[model samples]
Target: MKENANSALKIVASFVFVFAIVGVLYVVYFNSNGQPSTDVPVGVKTFGSCSAMSSFIKTNAQKSYPSYWGSGVVRAFTGVTGAISASPSMAEGGKATDYSTTNIQVAGVDEADITKNDGKYIYTLSGDKVVIIDAYPAESAAVLSEIAFNSSTERVTEMFVNGDKLVLFGDKTDYNGPIMGAEISYRPYYYRTSSFVKIYDIVDRSNPILTRDVAIDGNYYSSRMIGDYVYVVLNSYVYEDIVMPNITAGGVETPVAGCADVQYFEDVVDSSYSLTTIMSINVNTEEMSEKVFLTGNTQTMYVSTDNIYLTSTQYYYEPMPLVGDFFPRSEEKTLIKRVGINGNTVEFKAEGSVPGWILNQFSMDEYNGNFRIATTSGHVSRSGGGSSNNVYVLNGSLDTIGTLEDLAPGEQIYSARFLGDRAYLVTFKKIDPLFAIDLSDPTNPNVLGKLKIPGYSSYLHPYDETHLIGIGKNAIEAEEGDFAWYQGVKLSLFDVSDVANPKEMSMVSIGERGTDSYALNDHKAFLFDKEKGLLVVPILLAEFDAEPQSDWDYGEYTFQGAYVYSVDLTSGFTYKGRITHVTDDSLLKSGYYYESPYSVKRSLYMDNTLYTISEKTVKANSLIDLSELANVSLPYEGSDYYYGYYGV
Candidate 1:
């Protein structure tokens, strides 16, 4: 939540490769408009026609990239390529106690987050260190083990836990290597980085044994887990003529030793040095496989049960803007590639193109052999100029079947969610327009209903089949024509019981003028359980004496923590309370919202217990009365940890 280096590729036709060991193989194509090109059920397309792919690159890649970027764009997308989870946190164990897993997009696929649970113990990244808490007997909870990153760039960001093994993903800056027999003078100030994956065996609970240390060039783009395999994507730009990777499987291997292990697509050599390598590692067997895509720098990625979608934006260098325009002047197009994931193999599926760019992973969904996507088309412009939003329905081949284009003319998409046969879209300019779209028929998707509300939503999640929860900021119309000033964090519940008429059933705004929450930008921080009727979010509230004079005037910090709410399907929202790790009075008296420096960033439910975590503490509260039952403060002195060293 996250394979080996060798893979068996089964060519479906002449261009597509199906990675399935034993299953149905399909050869899909699209006509001029975007639909199935043929009706063939099985065939082979292993590496695609070299001549046709070259021609496609010549026609599309150059025009797709900006002249400034030069050779960064792909020559022929007419070629092949490769590239989340689809589920919620499931309570797997006993009825009296249920633990939460990572909230994912697909049921079987899991996405790595900051925190992970293995039923009995909860593993979380606290600053640059990881803390494993023995959180079973509510009253006897305590920190089990703590592991800190050894280097500055090795700051742990996310992790995944499966059985007795824990995999941690982090990034580190590149330091100057030894030259001749002596080390280089000093490292550059610029950020030259590498991504690291550390696999640890936590079977002993008290002492975690680091099993594998896999370091890859480039920064971490994204990752996913399906069954026993962990797939990680790293995007790197070639800088020096020589590159070395440090890998520790059986023993420590230098750049020279690991050099021979690096492989690339021989047919497409990336002149731009933009390299994207996807590595799949098996946690159970420790077998690893990698695939490299030249000039395939990923922007947004979506992973399904059987397929992966990689999206890249192509900047089209064009004529100058009219006098005073920056953003509205540029023209761009986005390309999507599909890759097959079977057991330990990842094979190229197909490729397609769309007009503009996508927002995030939430904007794409796979359901009933149809992939539905929402995109904000064109550059943002004054008046509706060329700006508009659209929704497209693509079949298994990724051909456009039905489309609702030029929607909400002047607005761009903020968030989108596709549930089963239904799709929900939120676009904002001055006011938020929540649209409920009916996708019962892929060939004819129409907006069933729309509700206009204040502010906008950045993330959308399903509460039930007919309910949705939105997390964003509350804003008020400003002096400008259609401008708004964003305020505190806003949590809204929408009732979509009637597809023809969706309504905001309950709306709640917390904090003061400049409050913010991690949930607004990161969906993983949001915790919602329908059966438990619980909603929890991390917030940093700020109070303003009056309307601020400028945007930077973030007001005075007041309170920082998590907000607990008992949400009812029909009754709306009921405020439970706020949980904070800060207990310093002198620091709180200084008008700082996050007095403890470390603030609560996430919350999850373990049966009837609610757990809130910060960089230095973990608190458990009863689900019924919200009373603190157990608390464990992490032991890491201020200057001991690279990240927590600041102690500000």
Candidate 2:
């Protein structure tokens, strides 16, 4: 989901780079051009030497901020806390079998997720540990091994399982809690966060051996695994003093990106700046490659087999004389930088810009050598004024070739999915408008059809070439504002066989006003199999017996589990059964209350048994009938930080 403009922070950084007092600004000066420019720089320039890099940074650092900088205040360093395709694999080189893999955008490329499996075993990150489960037969499923970290200041975010190798990514921060003295001492380096990657030889599942451990100075952004190569992205903030990001591997530390390795565009600059680094490691050979780009903070990343696209939102002010030009209008644009990847080698490819801001990584795609993107141009205010959606096609060189503008005016794009030559977009204000776009012409793309509905979908998944599955919320149009009041969690099946007339074949709504599902926003939480005609989503059902006080009144949490369904073209969605990790004891003690640790967050199926995973337990059930077969308790305990308290 996109962050609201009013709440989003504006970042500006100026740092003394390398061995000098000279400062460099990663931001572009607003005054350099009187108006926004469509003439985005084509290629990136490399800082050939430290002196050249220092000079470039120094020149940009001295540039003035945007005209609308005063609209938001800058607060510094408050040390406050905080799919249809199953890859058939052989277990131990045995007979080839079928098991569900990560639902990824690109076919060959794999995305990191909380849980991963390889036919016989399941690997998941439970709190601060990586639990490996022997999950072949449902009746005998059990936890095999676990790797734990320091629960005080370390966290494992996600991981990938490839054959005998298991790659894990996480963060380690220095600041555990706030100082408790009568007089608090604040330092610039009070909070230091570094992202780390660990590779383990899981050939011995019972005793996984750590082969390599590497740490880099930055916060984890995103990661992808392709074949034997895994790519990790990190964003490191540049402070007032010169402090280059470093990489520590095998007990030796080195600069992740030296002055010579850093690249930037002279024509692009924004308020937010960071050292965006992309690191590729060969899982088999343990070889690593790194490249750094000086740009605005990385917002959304789209990785294909050949390239990785990083997008960052850039804002510029336009003088509106009619509104007293003194208050400049903030205009948003997305800066896109593409880096080509071949095995373990990653190289800077091209750079470009789009007129509007993208919703997420799903808003961008690459097909048949052309790059496609969907964006929202103007800001949508409370009055629903002057906001429109757009789609732009860029060639291999990152130059605009085709344009589709002013789509669904007065509304913003809520969900987008690109399949082959067609794109599906959902935009909303008071109701949802699902647009079916034809991109076969590339240059003259137009809307083939549009379907208006009551609510909007935050995520769209392809059921097939001619169908789609949407998971979001049901809603009612408000009497006053241009927005709608969202209610129960909703699932809709769309048939797009007729490009000129798309239709919602069937739909289902769950719970009451405050119901939600993790699949709504996170695609990884969604599971579907065409062969088995199965669909699973983690749902948090909220319902109340008392009438709602108002449209905004929320319902009480009544259920937390995975909703299983049998979906088909003829019958739409058939509610199979639900699986819950919450024990009967907890349910009786708290009534309808929610237990954070028992909330099911992910679900996966292995052959005949389905696995529903929570922080506290992994429950296995029969795929035919939702009967519990086995349950394994996990070693995760809620911490003070998780309960909203600081270190105590």
Instruction: Compare the candidates by lDDT and give the number of the best one.
Output: 2
lDDT of 2 by residue, 422-490 (tens): 999999888899999999988987999999999888899999999999988888988888888999999
Residue-by-residue lDDT tens digits, candidate 1, 1-648: 001111211111111111100111112222222222333222333224434434333333333322111232111222211102113344543322466666677778889888877656778876668889888656888898999876556778788887789988888786654343321222112345778888999988789999888776678878898888898877764322334333334555433112222222333222123456667789887677665553445767898988888776554434544346433244545667677787766676666666667788988988887788888876444454566888888887878898888888777888999899889999887789999999999999999999999988889988888999899888787675656778778999999999788899999988566787888878888888877788888888778878778643566777777899989876789999988876654343234433343567777777788888877788999989899999888764444222223333
Full-model lDDT for every candidate: 0.67, 0.75
TM-score of 2: 0.86
lDDT of 1 at 73: 18
Candidate 1 is scored at a TM of 0.79
The parts of candidate 2 lying over 4 Å away from their true place are: 1-82, 91-96, 175-190, 319-328, 584-595, 640-648
- Candidate 1 ranges with C-alpha deviation above 4 Å: 1-96, 176-192, 239-248, 251-273, 321-328, 381-386, 544-555, 585-597, 638-648
Clashes of each: 32, 3
RMSD of each: 10.4, 7.7
- The TM-scores, one per candidate, come to 0.79, 0.86
Pairs with steric clashes in candidate 2: 24-57, 25-61, 28-269
